[model samples]
Target: MQTWDVIVIGAGPVGENVAERVVASGLSAVIIEAELVGGECSYWACMPSKALLRSGHARRAAAHVRGTGVHEPTGPGAGPDVAEVLARRTSFTSGWDDSGQVEWLQGVGVDLIRGHGRLAGDRVVEVSTANGTDRLQARCAVVVCTGSDAHVPDALAAVSPWTSREATSVEEVPGRLAIVGGGVVGTEMATAYRDLGADVTMLVRGQVLAGQEPFAGELVTASLTERGVDVRAGVTVVSATRDGGPSTPVRLTCDDGQVVEADEVLVATGRRPRTDDLGLSIVGLTDGQWLDVDDTLRVQGAQWLYAVGDVNHRALLTHQGKYQARAAGDVIVARARGTEVLAGQWQRHAATADHRSVPQVVFTDPEVASVGLTAAVAREAGHAVRVVDYDLGAVAGAALHADGYGGRARMVVDTDRQVLLGVTFVGPDVAELLHAATVAVVGEVPIERLWHAVPAYPTISEVWLRLLETFGREG
Candidate 1:
């Protein structure tokens, strides 16, 4: 058995962050990864999905431009090249090599181990690779950033539904796709497949795809419908059975007793922690695991152990995981030096405050970007809040972006603090508008200060001014 200063398992965003910070602290570290060094988000989750979404957005723009009297068509779907779009997205996400990322780790002075790693005991890791089984103990710490697995609904558990793994790396797009769970994954995949020429149908338990914000569900559904996607909302899959050809046809009975069939079924329900086979029990965890962490991203009782990203079940976004990783890395250094790690320092130093101020963008046409709390959440959290919501129709910028540039943007403010508690923007190019709100929220800037920030005239950013005015706070 060989002992190292630190061993980080799962070389994803979080693990990379942890390793990066640890090496910067002059601490020796090793990263063990069984699959791609960049992990799911790089190849599939965020990068690929966003790439796919960008293609769809381009396609929609082309469609709009065709009838425009002023402009000519350009971009991905300039003349309907689905093949080109898929190929472009595939290449962008893969980036041609895992070796490049591994090289980056080497550049930072971190040892890279290509293998599967599990905790054999506290500060001890058992590795399984082509080289063979070896026991490696960490002289300083063991970190887990294993991430999560795409969820397969129990209704189609035995039917072998397609998980995100298959959806991401399919040799060819399905002729017809039926997706379960209208969350971000499902809707983003819908944008992917629908643009790539698949007959797509999304069955959602809720009214729309992750439509937690006001009028959001209706807006997304409208866009998908415009793109020829069938969105059946408030419909639960009562039964799922595979039948017919070698690939099999999926039969779904809806809650309202409507029957539907599709060539392929995709389970985009959610993701579960990738802790199943990992031997975490030695650290007081079950065969299947949960995120064991305190305020500083430290695994509850394990002095030198930490878990981040999807494994923590906090934000689950790649950015959030990286944030958690940064905290865990700092915490490791602090503990080694006998310095105390404060919980309040979470967001200031790292992404530890994901639950408090996390920004998520749903890359759909007329995109969805939200950060911090929602109006309901702010109220529930006992904040005396003022909610200001504005329609894009009311803004000159939205009207100029495109005809019928209908959208909604909302700001939730803690009236007492006169600061934004949350912000939601659902519309075209609204994705870019999120950072402004995120900065306001994170900086705890007062509404008066925000008004002084001022948006450029005749631009979408002007919506910020309109929203603030709606709340009775204006320059």
Candidate 2:
């Protein structure tokens, strides 16, 4: 019965950005959310997880320095106060409340429908609310920003293993926690729970941080091991059994007939699109499938429909999803107003970075920060590439930052173009060093020109200078 210029199916950061952008461009927008308006990143994934990890990072950083009077705890109990850390994590999520997010939505003049929204054909969204079902129409575009959900293997389903949602929002640290998968979520939770005084075991089917540079996994694996985490790589959980209810311990049987017992188990394997019940079949798209989108984020074969964020499977990170949202929103507006829709690569209305220049940071101890392509990827893309490596500890700033600082920096250069195609930094607090690398790679800054962008002395950022030095300006 009602209509808006745009209808966003989810109110996560990606949906919020798209709605905000469209509303700012003079299009009326409405967001339909079944849960918290702030979505997973705000309540469960990004904010709370980082909050849980930060205190541990600070504690370790202080302990590493000589005059701080802090030392590594002999046992987990000696680390950061668990109660205070959990409370702080809760505070970051506003105690899992979304009133502030709702207020912001209202302030921006975007309407909200609190319900489940599903496609019912072109430009029509049927929302199921507590009162009843209401059919709404979109005058301009229908954007699906439904995001994603954690994929739990069928074998582990009955055991009620924790996902990223449960892991980040847990009120109590388990006495013994077992984590499966060595990707970002698994590694991060392993780091956090270990620091929070839990006996942690990681059963990884592959190397940790496998998507990043191999050295990243090696360094993180070393750090976690030194910190008392039992990391078993190339190990798979064949089955899981929890005999009782929530209070029971979980028993995991591995492929090698080894059994691991834990107070809690977390599965961080992967994510799948949240399109199962969105009525996509009515619109000719399959349910529970990742939507395909063009560079402009328009759904393939559907002119008026757009899919952004994790739903499109292009850069599942929250920040990257927001980046795609911005482009999608602008392009939708342009098309609506009969203006120029700049769809060229790297244009104002294109999400080119999703393919060529995405940046990611894993907040484990000795954080992993990377942007653009890895060396292997660049070569596979058929670029004549040269990889430059530098010992981050050799940089004066890194040494000054922490005693016995250990880390590595790598830059993959396109030899034919003499520009950086990728940069990876694995070390303590190297996350802050990522943006400059992102700019250089995204801007396609030539190595010759980078020589003039001198890094200031005595900071982890000076790794840039060291990396360039290792690469040699002329070469």
Candidate 3:
């Protein structure tokens, strides 16, 4: 038996981070990846999707600056050829090959195996390679970091609906597009396709961009609506039809009994954890499709197995997965050192924010980024919630930079702790602004000190100061 200290399955962000950390901690580990070394986030979810949105964002930004000093032509760098943009994105994400990642793994002394590995028995993994079946033994632990897949609603069956993959990788723009769901994927797709010169309609279950701060959807709706996107809120997509030449049509019957249609349909409702074919059955875990993990990311009741990333149904963001991996790796290192001093405190590193502070970002022109609890959620959790908001129009930077200047910001404060319970930012380039709030909330930074961390003058971030002032008065 070729036994190792740790075996990490699914070499995505979470698994890669875990393996890297383990190597640094002086433990031998191997990363087995079935597909591309970087996994779905590189090719599908974050990298490519963000790249697609970047095209739209850049063009819109340039248009906003047309009459200003910092300005560019309204035309996309892709002018009549999105292949250039797609090719650039593909290259950036994959570096045109997986060899770079494999080399990195090797350089870090983490063994890289390109094969499908599944749990076969106790502390054993059966890797099905082209050569043959190679059973690898992990004397210490196995980490599962397989990510999630786009969930396709049953209402639109037997039709080739564009998931994030197709939307991000499309070679040609359709004449019109209909996006189902107003979540991150759907809204970004709506923005991306529309900027690519498609008439887009967004069908959302609740108000458009629902999970964001209360007034956020209003700003996003105004922006998308201005850009010729038919914004239908409080609606659900009933079904889809595909008697098509190039475009796949989807028809939506909303809650208000409104009917809408479009050239192509994108089902961007949400994602389901990838928990198939990797032999979960062998782990004595057969109840839920997803393998639940305790803190330290150990599989529930199975110390030898850990599940991270979307595989554990935790926070799906790439950064959160990396955090999980780091924690799991430390756990393995501590166990190998025979230091059982702190029994299970490190396990809190495993998807702790999966429930509490899972942040989300929708990269629309007036982007929406939120973390922690929404007002309703905080109230549901029984916190005496006080929400303070600011209109972007009031901030100097927002007013000057936004051309028309339409956006909103809201902070949900837990009155008891005087710390931010949740945050929402909706405006141009606000996605980057989320981290500041995320750190503040995650660190439980007292709101008083947070006031001193100054955002640049004449920059949109200065809205933070204005927002804090507003909160002070409201409270």
Q: Which candidate is the best by lDDT?
A: 2
Candidate 3, residue 355: lDDT = 68
Candidate 3 per-residue lDDT over residues 1-475, each given as its tens digit: 6888899999887788999998998989998888888888877778888887786577667667647454432333333246666676776677537788888888999998888888888888889887888899998998888788888988864577788877876777777787888877887788777766777888887877666666777777888797678987777766555666434465656657787666678888888777777787776766237778876788888868998888777777888888778778887888878876243432444455666777778788788888999999899999988888888767888777767667788888988989988998877878878888888877778889988899999888898898888888876
**Which lDDT values do the candidates have, in the order given?**
0.80, 0.93, 0.78
Clashes of each: 0, 0, 2
**Candidate 2 local lDDT, 194-231, one digit each (tens):** 98999999999989999999999999999999989999
TM-score of model number 2: 0.99
Ranking by TM-score: 2, 1, 3
Which tens-of-lDDT digit does each residue in 350-447 have in candidate 1? 45457678888888777899989888888889999888888976788777776667789888889898899989988877888888888888888987
Instruction: List runs of model 2 lying over 4 Å from the truth.
Output: none
In the order shown, the candidates' Cα RMSDs to the true structure are 2.8, 1.0, 3.0
TM-score of each: 0.93, 0.99, 0.90
Candidate 2 global CA lDDT score: 0.93
Cα displacement (Å) at residue 349, model 2 = 0.8
Candidate 1 lDDT (Cα, 0 to 1): 0.80
In model 2, pairs of residues that clash are none
